[model samples]
Structure formats: C-alpha cells, structure tokens
Target: MAFSNDVKIKALVACARCCCICHKFCGIKIECHHIIQEADGGSNSFENCIPLCFDCHADMLSYDDKHPKGTKYRPDELKFHRDGWTSKINAARPADYCDEHRKLDQGLFLRILRRLPWNGSIGFISTNNFAGFSFDCRALLDLHELAACNDDPSWEFIDPTLEIARANLAHHVSRFLGLIGMNTFPTDNPDRNSVPEEWERERPEHFFQVVDEIHEAASRCVDSYKTLLREGRRRLAIESPADEEPTSKPKT
Candidate 1:
C-alpha cells in the first residue's frame, strides 16, 4: 500500500533543510524520503527517514540507474556539528515487502530474493554492533543472471517456510544496503550542494538507469517466483491445489 498521509506529514515536519533541487521545504508541495525505502521494508519510523524537496527527490531518482529502493549517503559522507548531529542515518531497513505483491508463493518469492545480489552486504549497517556488512548475503541466496552471488552450496532451499524466512532476511539486508547507497565503505556521497557533476553529463540516462535497475530486479524477482512454483515445492506454487501464501514479515 502507498504510505499513509499521516506518515507523510510526520516525515515532512521533521525536515531540516529545503530540497536541493526545488527549494521546497514542506510536505504539501515538497516531499520526505526515507534514506531507506519504506517499501523495501524500511520503517516509516523517523530514525531512517529524511525530508526533501520534490526536486531533490526527482534529482536523486534521476541520479542513478541501479537505484530501486532509492539510495543512501555513505556513513562517512555526512557532516557533524557542535551540537552533535552525527550526520548518520540509522541505516536500518526491512528485508522484504511481500505485502506489496500479494500474489506469490513463499518459495517463489525466495527464489527471486536469491537472485538479487546483496550489494549492501558489502558494508551497510551497524545493527546493535554489526558494521561493514556484518551480515551474510550468502544465506540470502537464490537463482538468476544479472545479479547472482554465484553461491552454489551457499544456497540450499529446505522447505518453503525456511526459504521464505531466508528471503525475508535478505529483504531487510537489501533495504539496509540500498538505504546506504551503492557503496557502504565510507558513505562518501557529497553533501547538499548547488549541483552535482552527474547532472551535467548524462542525467536523464542516469534516471533511466535507476528505473531500469529497479524494474529489472523487481521484475526478475517476480518472474522467477512464478517459475519457482511450477518447478519447485512451495505448497502455493502449484496451479490450483495448495495453501495460502504467508503475509508480511514480523514487524522489525
């Protein structure tokens, strides 16, 4: 479901700066963005969110082709001040958004998750104590072409339930990584500047790239899932006789 209006307002109200692109600074005309996507299982919770102008949002959406869950600045990219604004978003995010696609089996959903490369696993969060890719993306395995982790024994689907659990875990991890941007190494994204370099050279293509990447990953995930049901053993994978697929992940 689309995020609620109430959530939107709360997010906007917390804005610290106007959007870099549009100069808008409020929710009605401007917009708020979670560094991590609420759809990617990122929480609507304030800790992982940011408010921006519609122009800035548009700019970011056009910033890269590989962005689906949107992007995040690297941890070290932000600036710190005297009052103690640490300049780091919590960077926590959920692993999946099964609720958004309520027409698939657990196993198939997992097959899709397996195919998606966990880019965030490189260095995305500080969960309680975790840092620099503290988690294992190998366990978040599946099958695919464009973004496979190429882990053979690394991915072994047990039953449908276990597979779903693994995918759910992967969903959160992906959310975490995407919330931190393409690289988690040091969060080196530049701060709010007048204009960035990429804007001049090939911006529209960059936006198209983000669109393509998200579509490719999401489409691949959805498409493979259908195949999973036919060739696999998730109860709901069959054409007719089966159980209902599970719902959203446990609230994280």
Candidate 2:
C-alpha cells in the first residue's frame, strides 16, 4: 500500500495540537513541509516530511536562490535526515513545547546547563538500561524549560520505546526508595486531583516526608561507622595493641 491514511491524519493532528508551532513559538507555522522537495525524486514518506513554520517552508524552497541564478544544493541537502528529539519536533510533538526545543538533542535547558562554568550535578535516578531510562534526561530538561516558561504538557515521549522505558524507570525509583525507607509519593488518590480525600486521611502525609527523615537517619549512622574505621586505623598505626598494656600482676 501507499502512505497510510492514518499517518497523514497524525501529521495534521499534530499540527493543530501544537497550533502548527505558530502560536507558541516564533518560527513555526501551521504546515508540514517536505524537507526534500516533492518534485525532485521524493516520495510520500515520513522522513521526507517535517513540520515547518509557514515562512520556513518558503525559505527552504528559496535557499538555493541566495547563491546564484542557476545555483544548486549539495547532494547531501537532498538526502539529509536530522535525528533525535529535533526530528521528533519536525515530525510532531506535544502541544506545549516549541519546535526549536523539540528538535534539540538535549534541548534548550541543558544547553544552558552545559554553558555554565561548573558542570551541574543533576542526579537522574532511573533504571540502568537505555530501554528503561533513556527518555528521563531529555524529558527532565524539557520539563525544566517548561517550568521556567510557566507552561507544559502532561508527558513527552521521544521514541516509541520511551513509554516502556519510563515505566521501568519508575520501578527503579520505587525500589531505591524502598531500600532507604521512603514510600509511595504524590498521594493515594486514584484520580490524583491533589485534593484531600478520605483515603489519604488515614496516612500521616500525602508526600515523601518520611523519606527525608530516613535520609537524615542514614547520615547519622555513617558517623558511627566512621568512628569504628578511625579506631581501627589507630590500632593499625601502632605495631601491636601496645602489647595489651602488659598484664599487670596484682601483689596481695
């Protein structure tokens, strides 16, 4: 069969959901433009299409015009394929983020993190496998940007595998917390409305306060361990345990 009708509908739905990148961002317009011009040798394929701001489409067609009267593109331009989140934005994205952010591998927020004089130690806790935790970093960076902008979406997935990856990652986070004694977070409400309800009334708090307390307890335990280590080091420093202080014979 030719291009699936569902695919085209997906493209259109994405455009409307993001408002064609028109409403939220500067460069995006409401049209999905073919990266490789349809006239040359391109076919109706997902790779050939990208969501373009209206002006970008026109600018792309005219790119060669800037060079000369009979100028041409390098063969690479015709066959090029951008990868990662950038490609996702071009293909389609959540309604909240702009095309510019979507097209980024690390997106805009991490770009700022990279630029800083110090490498920020942002700890991401998730499953070890790429299949499990790959999307967490990119999604987190995007969420950081969203918060900065004071707007966002419920979720973002860069790859089809991302959904499964996230579920596994959540498992890891839960397991890690269990090891440390913190418990389920956010709330017990099935709907997660953030409203107080009867189910949570039985629980002390609807958040991870116990988790914080356990961490503090763990820190104090380390001090006792350190004292043992220091005592051992002092004993090791002396050739013997001072010869057991020479047995004192009591003279009666």
Candidate 3:
C-alpha cells in the first residue's frame, strides 16, 4: 500500500522538504519514497518513508540486481542516510540552519562566478552580435557543468529569495545553452569558438530569428547571474575578490 498522508507529511517535515540523500531543498518537488519496496512487505508507516527529490527517487529505483553495473544503494544505507539527515534537520534551529545554508550558498555562488566571470564569454555573448560570434568551447563546457549542478543537492540555498534568484539564473543559462547547441557547430581550432551552423545560410530569416533569440537569451542569463551575485552578496554576506570588478564590461 502507498504511504498514508500522515507518514508522507512526517517524512517530508523531518527532512524539511529536502531530499534525504542529497539534502537538496525540493519544496513541492519531493516524494516520500519507501525505504523497502511495498512488494517486499514494507509498511506504510513513517519509519518506512524517506523524502527524496525526483532525480534521487529515479536513481533509487534504477538498481538492476541481475545485471548490476555497479554497487546499488542498499536498504540499510538508505535508512542510515535518511535517519542521519532527518536527525540533523530536526535538531537544528531554523536560524542556525539558515546560517549554515547561507555559508554553503556563498561558496556555490563563487563557483558560478568562476565559471561565468564578469569579463568572460557570458558577458561577450550578451553584448556582441550572434551572426559571426562564436563562444569558446571551454566556456561552453563550463556552462554545461554549471547547468548540471542545478540539480545537485549540495549547496542549495535555503533562503527563499536567494533560491528564487538561483532558479532564474539556472533557467536563463539552460535557455542560452540550448539555443547555442541548436545553432552552432564545432570547429577544428580548439582555441577558437564554435561557428554558426552551415544550415543558417540556407534559411537566412530563420537564422536571424535564432540569432536574435540567442542574443536575448544570453542577455537574460547575464542579467539573472548578476542578480544572483548581488543577492548572494547582500543576503549571504559573500565576499567579492579585490581584483575582480562585478560591474566591469565584457572583454572585447
């Protein structure tokens, strides 16, 4: 049988609506997973329930015992992780927990800044024409890495305002990357940027439309990133580097 409302609510509350395994704040995007499958006689009790995010829930269920590629998460391990995380969440005061989250979030924002430096390719893409502009392959890799981290549970901001800003930045970054991937082609020169796809020549209007979309998307990414940086610094007390200028123009 499925977990009852009481069991689900209790598990979610114990984990503060965060994934028990990754500790990512999931809010409404969380599920109460059974530690032991119901088919295996797992009861619909709070003790058998573990709150998890959508991705973690999928991973938890993907273990193929017969065709095992790697070690699967054991039931004992899942219980340990759930109990440990829930204990921590239930023990800490709201203010203290938020303080710890703020510190971790500062580091996360710093990592993001490193990937998208103020005078780096992101800024360049925001200001330059997309017609002949090519983004550095390495920069694209950094963006991909940053995008991947959006789902990572570690270092998720607990502050609602900061979380909202982070989500906005992630959305814009993903949009920018999607537009580029669809419209660009890799070049032989490793040091140079990827060039626009040859198909653009066959459909000039469509190409222009994509170019405008890309430019707008890039601008939104930069704007959202800057907003995150400002909010993180102000609310989380993040320190900016002395040599780095957050307001500096993109490198020409």
- The most accurate candidate by TM-score is 3
What tens digits encode model 1's per-residue C-alpha lDDT throughout 175-202?
3335324422222433311122343256
Reference-based lDDT, each prediction:
0.36, 0.34, 0.72
Please provide, for model 2 over 1-252, each residue's C-alpha lDDT reduced to its tens digit, 9 standing for 90 to 100.
Answer: 234566555655443323222122222334555555566776667665554445434655676655665445443453342233344444443355455544442232233223211111112212111111112223224223322332122233342123122222222223333433223223444322222233235553632344343333323222222232233234223121122111221111
In candidate 1, stretches whose alpha carbon ends up further than 4 angstroms from where it belongs are: 20-27, 65-252
Considering lDDT, which of the candidate structures 2 and 3 is the better prediction for this target?
A: 3
lDDT leader: 3
List all candidate RMSDs to the true structure. 19.9, 22.3, 6.1
Model 2 accuracy (lDDT, Cα)? 0.34
TM-score rank order: 3, 2, 1
lDDT of 3 by residue, 1-252 (tens): 688897787788887787777665678988888888888888888888888888789887887888887668778899997987776667653455666676677787787778667666665655656675565666556668778887675645656556656766776778788888777776677555543556467877777787778767877877787787788788767675433433433332
